[model samples]
Target chain A: MKVPILKQGNILIATIQSALTDQDLISLKDNLSHQVIQHRSHGVVIDITELDVMDSFSTRTLRNIASILKLRGADTVIVGMQPDVAFAMVQLGLTLPNVKTARDLEEGLTLLK
Target chain B: MEKDTESEPTSSYAYNLMKEMKLDEEEILHRKAWLEFEEPDVNRLLELNDMAQGYATEVIESLYDHFLKFDDTKKFFEDPQVLNRVKNLQKKYFLRLTNGNYDDQYIQERIKIGSVHASIGLDVKWYLGAYGFYLRAVGKRIFKAFKSNPEKALESYFSLEKLVYMDIGLAIDTYIYQREATIKIQQEAIRELSTPVLQLREELLILPIIGAIDSQRARQLTEQLLHAIRDKRAKVVVIDITGVPTVDSRVANHLVQTVDASRLMGATLIITGLSAEVAQTLVTIGVDLAKINTVGDLQGGIEEAERILGYHVTKSLEDDSK
Candidate 1:
C-alpha cells in the first residue's frame, strides 16, 4: 500500500492506496496517529480510491483510526469508496467511525482545505 | 462358479472374500439372506417412518397456517417467494427427519433452517412457539394412531420425538449464533456512526460533517464539538460544511447550538462552505447567522484567520508587499 503524506496550507492529505486489510489498518492507525500528533494538522483527508474490499475487521480498524485521530485533535475523512463497496458494507452492517466519505479525491481534498 | 446347493455349509471361499473385502459384513449378510430379511414384513417400519413424516409435516403446516392467521406473523411471510421457500424447506426437513439419518446431514439441515430464520430476523420466541405447536400436533397424531397397536405405536412415537428434539435443538443453536453475529454488526455500526470530533491544535479545531444529519447525529455532533473545543483549548473551530449538502431545521439547530457551545468554551466557530443554495435556503428559512462567523470557503476562512492573527496569508503575498 502506498500512503502519500502531503501538506497543503493548514490541511494534511494522506492518500491511501490498495486494499486496507487488518494489518494495513493497524499500520495506518499507528502512522496516521503519530503524524497527527506530530504535525497537529488542522484537517486530515484519507484518499481510499484504490481500496476495494473492506471487511468487518478492516472496518473496526478504520474506526480505531478515527478514534485515535479524534484524540489527537485531527478531523478525518475517507474518500473514494466505490458505490458498490459502500452498498455491500451497508448490507454487511459495517460502518467506519463517522468518517466523511467523498465520491472522489478532489472532493475530499477540497473538504480538507 | 460353484454349483448352488439348498444346504451349503458356510464356505471358506465366501469367508475369505468377506475378510478380504472392505464392504460392511452386515450389509453383505443381509444381501445374501435377502429372502429371509424380506419375509420379516419390515413394511411396518417403513409405514411407521412414513407416518412419522406425515405427522411432522401436518404439524408444521398447521403451525404455519396458524401463524399466518396473526397479522404480525402474516407480515413475516408477506414476501411470496420467502414464504414459499420456507414452506418447501419445512417439508424437506420433515422428510429428512423421518429418513432415519440423524447423523451430520440431519444436524446440518437443521442449522441451515436456523440460519435462514435468523437472516429474516425471526426471533427465538417465534421459533419456540412454533415448535410447541408442532410437538403438540405430533403428540395428538401419535395418540390417534396408537388406538390399535399400543406398544409398537409407543416405540415409534418415542423415536420420532427424540429425533425432533435433536433437530430442533441444533436449529435453535444456529439461530442464536446468527442473531449474536448480526447484533454485533449493528452495535459496531452505531459506534462507527458516532465518531468524535477531534481538535488537532490549540488554534485549529476541525469538524468534518458527513452523512445525513439526523437528530441522533445532530446530538452527537453537538456533544463532540463541545468536548473537542474544551479539551483542545482551541481558539478557532472550523465547522467544515463541505460534506453537508443542505440542512434541515434540526441540523440547523445543531449547527447553531454548536456555535453557542463553542463560544461558551471560548472558541470562535467558523462556519465554512455556505454553498450558494444553502446560503439562499438559510436566508429563505429566516435562520439568522449574524451571531456565527461565516466563511465563503475553508481556504478563505484560514486566510482570514491568518490576517486577524497578524500573519501573512501566503509567502507570495508577504514578498509582493515587501
Candidate 2:
C-alpha cells in the first residue's frame, strides 16, 4: 500500500499504516527521496506508530532513506517507533547510525526547527 | 444426546508431548505392558461402561460433597453456575473412563484439564486427594454391580485403575510444565522491572542502575533506555551507575553500545556515579571509552544533561528581591 506523504511547511510527514511489504517500502524510499528534492523540503518525519513489526529489511530501508535524504539536504527524523519495536530492533543489532529520531511528529518538527 | 457429525481436529499434542518427554510409541506401549493393560483390559473396561454410567451421577455428587467439606477445594464452587458446569464436566470425565478409547485425543483432553487446574492455582495435594476419593467412590459401585461374579469384578477394577493412573500421569506432567512456564514469564518481567528509565525533565531522562549487570540485564537496560529516549523525546540522558557493583569488559561494552544506540535516536547519554574503583576497572580492562560521556556523580550528570539542553540553573529571584 502507498504511504501517504503530507507536506507541512518545509517538512514532509509520511504516516505508515499497517504492514508493508518489501516492495512497498522500496517504493516509499524512492518516492520519499524524489519528493524531498522536488519539494526542496528541509526535513522529513517518517511516522511508524501504526507499524507493529519492523524486520531487518525495513530497518535497512529506513536507514537508507535517511542517508539518501541527507544527501539531498533534507534532514530525516524517524518518529513514533513503538517501544516494543525499539527493543526488538536493538536486540537484533539494527540501528540507524547517525540518523535523528523523535518521539512523535510534533517532536520531530521541533527538532528540525 | 446427538453426536456432532464433525470430527475433532487431530491434536499434535500427543506427538509434541512425546518429543518433549523424549518418548516414542514403544516406550508408551512398554508402560502399558508394565501396567498389565492389554486388549483384555480394554475389553473389560468397555464391558463395565454401561454399569458405570448408571453410577456416574451418584459418584460425581458424592465427589463434590467431599470437596465442599474442605475450605481449600470448596472455594472453587462459590458460584452455583460454576458448580453446575463443573459437576457436568465431572460426569463426562467419569463416563469417559469406561469409554475405553485412550488415544491422542484422550491425552490432549487430560492435558487441557491439567493446565486449567494449574492455572487456577489449585494445589496438587488437593487434586491428589480428589483422585483418591474418586477411586473409592467408583470402586464401591463396581464391586456391588459384579457381586455375583467376584473374579470379573476384580479384573474390571484393575483395568479401571490402569486407565486412571495413565490420566493422572499426563495431568501431573502438564501441571508441572505450565507452572514452570509461568515462573519463567514472571522472572522475565522482574528482570525488566529491575531496569527503570525515569524521565527527569522535558527532553531529559535518567536511568538509575542498581545491582549486578549480567549480559541479559545489560540488554534489558539498553532496550529500556532507548525506548525512554524516544518516548520522552529526550535530548539528553543521564545514566547513574552508582549502585553497580562491578564493571567487567562485558558491562563496559554494553554501556558503550547503549550510548551508541541513544546517539542513533538523537539523544546524548551521560554516564554518572563512576566511583574511583569502577573508573580504575574500566581503564584496567582497556575498554575503548571514546564514545561514553561520563561525569563523577549523579548531581554532576543531571547538571551536564541540563547544560546540554541549554538550561542554566539560576538562583530564585525572591532571594535577590529580599
User: Per-prediction TM-score, chain A only?
Assistant: 0.85, 0.97
| TM-score for predicted model 2 compared with the true structure | 0.58
- lDDT digits (tens) for residues B1-322 of candidate 1: 0011222223443333223332244643443254232322243334566686656556666877888897767876777776666676666665554564343343444455555565666667777777677667766776688779777666656655555555566556666665676798997687556564655444676776765678777766666665555455556777778778778766776677666545433455788887888888888898867777888898877666555545654445455655
Q: How well is each residue in B1-322 modelled by candidate 2, as lDDT tens digits?
A: 0011123223464456545654456756776787777899889989988988888888888888988999988888888877887888788888888887776567667766765676677878887888888788878888898899988888888888898787787778877886787799999888877988888788888889999999988987887787777666787989999999898999998888787667655678899998899999999989989878999999999998898888999887776655
DockQ for candidate 1, C-alpha atoms: 0.03
* Poorly placed runs, candidate 2 (over 4 Å): B1-193, B226-235, B263-266, B280-288, B315-322
Model-by-model DockQ, in order: 0.03, 0.20
Best by DockQ: 2
Candidate 1 local lDDT, residue B45: 35
In order, the TM-score of chain B in each prediction is 0.48, 0.65
- The total of clashing pairs for model 1 equals 2
Q: How accurate is candidate 1 locally (lDDT)?
A: 0.62
- Which docking band does candidate 1 fall into? incorrect
lDDT of each: 0.62, 0.81
In order, what fnat does every candidate score? 0.00, 0.27
